[model samples]
Target: MRKWGLTLLAVFLTIILTACNQNDSKDEDKKETSEKTSQKKEASQDESGEGFKALKEKELNSQRNKKTTNDSSDNQIIDYTDKQKIAMLLFQPGLDDKFITADDVLKGEYQSKFSDGVKKKHLPKLTVTSLPENTQMDNTPTGTKFYNIQPFPSQYSVNIAMNEHNMIIFGSQSPIPDYNELLHGLDGMAKVYKTKDVIKSEKDNPKLKEVEDKVDMQ
Candidate 1:
């Protein structure tokens, strides 16, 4: 009877030790998985921070190295390409009497007009009036032309290309705050598609000449 009791005691001890070992193994595995997940999250955040820093440095360098050009002609013509037009429109003075800087656009301070379901202040709401009768602008896209005569003494028009389906127009009361910042922001946002400046001389737009003549007379 005594020998049988000793053997049963040993079997019970073995069972308890085996169960404890299994539990310890499971706990170790869970801890390792949690640690790996934490490490991955930290790495991702670090990469994002580095990328943002690099981009800001590149933009600053570009601004510092930008060149200035002077046109000797006295044409007094204001012309821009499709890409420039878009950038100028985007960076025009805002409600705060400031431009949407490249940093703002890059940092997601303002959403683009192309953003979906955006009812907020995504685009500038300019006051629009009809163009002068019988005045033709050569660069005017094949659509409607409306004169924006606010916030500036000189009147300009924005053409909406409905027929071509390549452009959309909205008016702004203010002009571009900084051309360099405009180009920088547009480039940062990957918004510039074309770089050539499309010139629209007063000779091409006879109405412009008429308006200038009237202004000079006044």
Candidate 2:
């Protein structure tokens, strides 16, 4: 009887140990699953936050651009420290025959780039303002926001227009960030073109002459 009792005691001990081991394995699996789920949630939240931040930044840029457009005085500062070259092109009415490449200037390759950011349905015109003066809309006829200089891609133009029967183009080899400054320039140049004093005038600055010389040489 004593031997039988000892055997039963050993069997009971083995059963308890097996049960404990099984329960421990299940607990470990649950803990691991909980940790994995937590990590996934953290990663998801991080991605969502970053997406929101990017969207907000894009909105801010659009709003600031509009504000710059609405207020002519809010001129964009030029980063000339980077050595941006200022250039312009002017086409006179009677003095010169209409530019032979005028069609190319208004359509093809250049016009395609201007439509990049906008949808096909909302094809907005490229904004042009006189640099330094940003007076494109000042003292001009109503209902006209400077002449749409075509095919001359705004990405390349920096400032451009076909105002008062004159083609005025302005740019910097280095991009001007606050294009409104160039808008001011567009306004000033358009104002000057009205007088038809693009060349050989006391008001013609050195840079303006250089641009004129470039087109004449071309």
Candidate 3:
């Protein structure tokens, strides 16, 4: 009877130890599963953030391209007669640097002195329309403001195109707060307006004599 009692006690203790070990193993597995779920959630959030950033960038680029296309399309040619051209010379006086120096004008002394030849030649067939003032596109990496002096007198900005070769001269007199902005703005304008036809016109007809001669000095 004593031997049987001892055997039974040993069997009961063994079964209790086995059950405790099994419970510990199950707790560890539950903890591991929770950790894996948390990691997957974080990864999903990161992917979503990156995708949103890419989408915003794409939208901004599309808007910029659309604006450029519309501006180019709107710049069409206009009709002006020889008499109308002569009247355009009156706008030249406004081209004088009222706020800046003679060197401040386009091409500096060269453009300024072109008027002398006009006075001597009695060129009354040309019409000179100054460019209208408007905000130019900024290309510099540094944050800055820029502007150009429009030769014409008007509140609304005007687009000046001379011939079928798509020869156009657009001008805008924008108010700038500082000198750096002016320089940057002028540089940008030169880059945008610079074209093969314009360069050739400047080279062949530096004085714009054809246009100048049409103006009536008297």
Q: Write model 3 residue lDDT over 1-218, tens digit each, in one string.
A: 99999999999999999999999999999999999999888778766888667888889999999998655533411243422322232233233322221222222222222323322122213223343333343332232212222332233232333322322223345533333343343443311222233333343334444334433322
How high is the CA lDDT of each candidate model? 0.38, 0.40, 0.40
Per-model TM-score versus the true fold: 0.26, 0.27, 0.25
Cα RMSD, model 3: 15.6
The numbered model that scores best in TM-score is 2
Candidate 1 steric clashes: 0
RMSD to native, candidate 1? 20.7
A best-first ranking of the candidates according to their lDDT comes to: 2, 3, 1
Model 3, residue 29: C-alpha shift (Å): 0.9
Which one wins by TM-score: 2 or 3? 2
Q: Is candidate 1 or candidate 2 better by lDDT?
A: 2
Worst 10 residues of 3 by lDDT: 97-106
Off by over 4 Å in 2: 50-218
lDDT of 2 by residue, 37-138 (tens): 999988787668886678889999999998876453222212111011112333233312222122222232122334466222222222223333334333
